[model samples]
Target: MIATVVSSYPKIPNRPSPARLRNAINRFDRGAITEEEIRRIEDEVTEEALQQQAEAGLDLVTDGQIRWEDEQTYLARQLNGISLNGLTRWFDTNMYYRQPVIEGAITWQKPITVDDYRFAVEHSEKPVKAVLTGPYTLARLSVDQHYGSVGALAKAYAGALNREAKALQEAGATLIQFNEPAILQHKREFEQFAGLCRSLVDGITVETSLYLYFGDAEGIYPQILDLPFQLIGLDFVMGAKNEALLQSAPFTKKLGLGIIDARNTKLESVDEIAERIRSLAAGLASDQIHVSPSAGLEFLPREVAQEKLRRLAQGVRQAEAVLV
Candidate 1:
């Protein structure tokens, strides 16, 4: 079993030292910092995030999405035919993300994250997993003013992301993930969303993941077991019912069992985390399991998130030792 983060890690800096990234963004907002200066600060924090993951002894790492303003707008800003307007509350979280307003046909103008992924791969000791906002989630969250039909809007987003996925693969990303928390929330739309995801990853050769969080996936249980992607990340922390569902229908497909709680500040004991991993692994091959946090750690302070990753890695090792 491996310890990996779901999508993002806390990008906030620990206290005592100044929050350069936060300060830089505030400076930029006031037209004080240059675009180049803001990017430089982003790079510095991205490196710090990657270094924290490496120090925690994770087998895989993400860029921590330090450059992303939010889950949706980062990718949307790169695509044509969309303009971001007004902040909207993101699901139940207190955080707000800029809403994308579609005005014309969506098209992928250039590589959205290839350069960013390459930078992470270059700096990190571990293999970096590239992440993209899933098309279904993007379509669901965004307001369509031009495309009238949801199907057309989803397909257009899917088409654009499909190209982006291929570009990441060609540029040497072994693993890429699509964040689709919207899927579990709108369970009735699973069939259509799954079909859209399947079409998005049709010919991409590299391994891919459809990461679902924010709620339980009980409604799509065994069907998720049959997904074409190489891995599926589900939130077992908030989606606790999924534990019972998985036990009722076990499979050998790689499952990212979210055992560590990223939402809380207190650290989960390594023994407790190991027990959850052990209980979850009893239903499948131990090698097919990857322990992760409930969701992104963006809400937590950086110090807490770093310790969580360390505990996660320790828990995996303990579980593996017992299994062996």
Candidate 2:
């Protein structure tokens, strides 16, 4: 399906807008402010960001992760297996995640799709992807509460989340992406995680995509080639070397080439990024490629992020011109 989508692809630039920032602010202010205030802000900011993506010429637009607290905790809230804990130090980066602590056996909190799909349909004309953190990644990031192996915990989480994905599909979502940045940490287990993820949404109408970021994807390249997902997101900012991995791996999966560095504030030039995309697309056909930022766009200031996305989207156009 990604191959078909890319075949006669329009000249579109994809970028993250101010939506994630507004969501972050709302996450922090949730208990402090009224629930009505949260909904109003989410609607207002999401509307503006969706318009900005369309105006910026983004081909495929996301909610910029506006509805998430962080990636993992968002799923935690939706699934009954865990509870959200306050921030904890991330390994090396200045980043800290709102951790999810497993409190009991896994279960769906309720039907998890209504609000996300409703918002996407209401806001954007372009295809909107419903994003969730993969269950295995969530379990890996969390400390086990008497569960023997992390894999067991991950599989349990996967079942509940896949149901959520199914619900999203029924509610009019056309694409559903599960973000699994932690999969890079467990190379030996990557394929199993991917398989488990695949099982969750197998027959669902939504086109499924899996995203990995924040680490070199070299070790997991071969493992990913056989997965059944329609699209795979790679973090070029951190995994540029994985560009070579793409050349070696023989698969027809759509590449979500994350060309923009999302964690930094300094805007990258269109020329530099265009050059990289040209080199990266050397063997890959135009139909095999899709472009995005390294990860979510909340790392930079709202203005910086906007500039970065604009340049990234423009860079793709410049690269396509060069290729043609």
Candidate 3:
């Protein structure tokens, strides 16, 4: 229903010498620093990023995700009935995530996104989106101890996520996004997972969005048409190039077209990104598109991340101007 700018997730890659991120991490890990201190660091980073968005002319902004351990781990830690183990290697380099080992039926220890929403509401002038890892993706990535089928586990996870969603909405979150990168890995499971999420939030007034990254939308086109979300975010940089998926799927949900590459360190040019948007607009209605990065900015250097986001906002403005 609205045009906006979104981040897949932004990170504060280790800062420069003397003013290092390690200083912040060390204090927190050692219990010498307070949560307020960590928040202060996040606030400072968020302020700079938001300013960049405003200058580059964007409608929506994220907190840059300086407060999270990882995109999925934030909510994974809040869920009950699971033991979170330290991240293991899923790919090359240090890429990792909190592995939720199912010990029993999953439920939340408390409201997962309330503090995140509260921080954004109090600190940010632009509308804030509360993000969550989708149930299907979570189940697929983690090991299930009790639930035999991934489908059954996904339903349980979705129910728990719905509770979190309700709490986030009540907390004044303007938008909620379910980040589902694993959707590209398996189509059938992703469809089932997306359906359960829709069922849980049925009739709810919240503006729910499903965010997919790292792969194409081809596999999930059949299910996306019927999903209850008001918006859908995709990683256009890494997603399949064919336009058939976009043409076939109903564009009822606004498209969060990720035009910027988040994993790469090289900054994208405004003109270059605008080209991607131009392509997307060929099939998607103008009003249906929102510009965004492809994945978490944590994968890129902090300076590179900031520059890419700023460029993305600029690209959006340029595209909007031409479209108008």
Instruction: Give the winner by lDDT.
Output: 1
Candidate 3 error regions (>4 Å):
1-10, 13-21, 34-36, 39-56, 90-94, 248-250
TM-scores of the candidates are 0.97, 0.86, 0.88
Q: Relative to the true structure, how large is the alpha-carbon lDDT of every model?
A: 0.88, 0.71, 0.71
Deviation in angstroms for 234 in model 2? 1.0
Give one digit per residue, the lDDT tens place, for model 1 in 73-114: 999999999999899999988899999999999999899899
| Residue 104, candidate 1: C-alpha displacement in angstroms | 0.8
- Residue 10, candidate 1: C-alpha displacement in angstroms: 1.8
TM-score of model 2 (CA atoms): 0.86
In angstroms, the error of model 1 at 147 is 2.0
Decide which is better by lDDT, 2 or 3.
Answer: 3
RMSD of each: 1.2, 5.4, 2.7
Question: lDDT tens string, model 3, 151-202?
Answer: 8888888888888888888887778888777767777665476578776675
Clash count (model 1, backbone only): 0
Give the per-residue lDDT digits (tens) of candidate 2, residues 89-130. 654466688888887888886776568567866888766677
Clash totals for all models, in order?
0, 2, 0
Best-performing candidate as measured by TM-score:
1
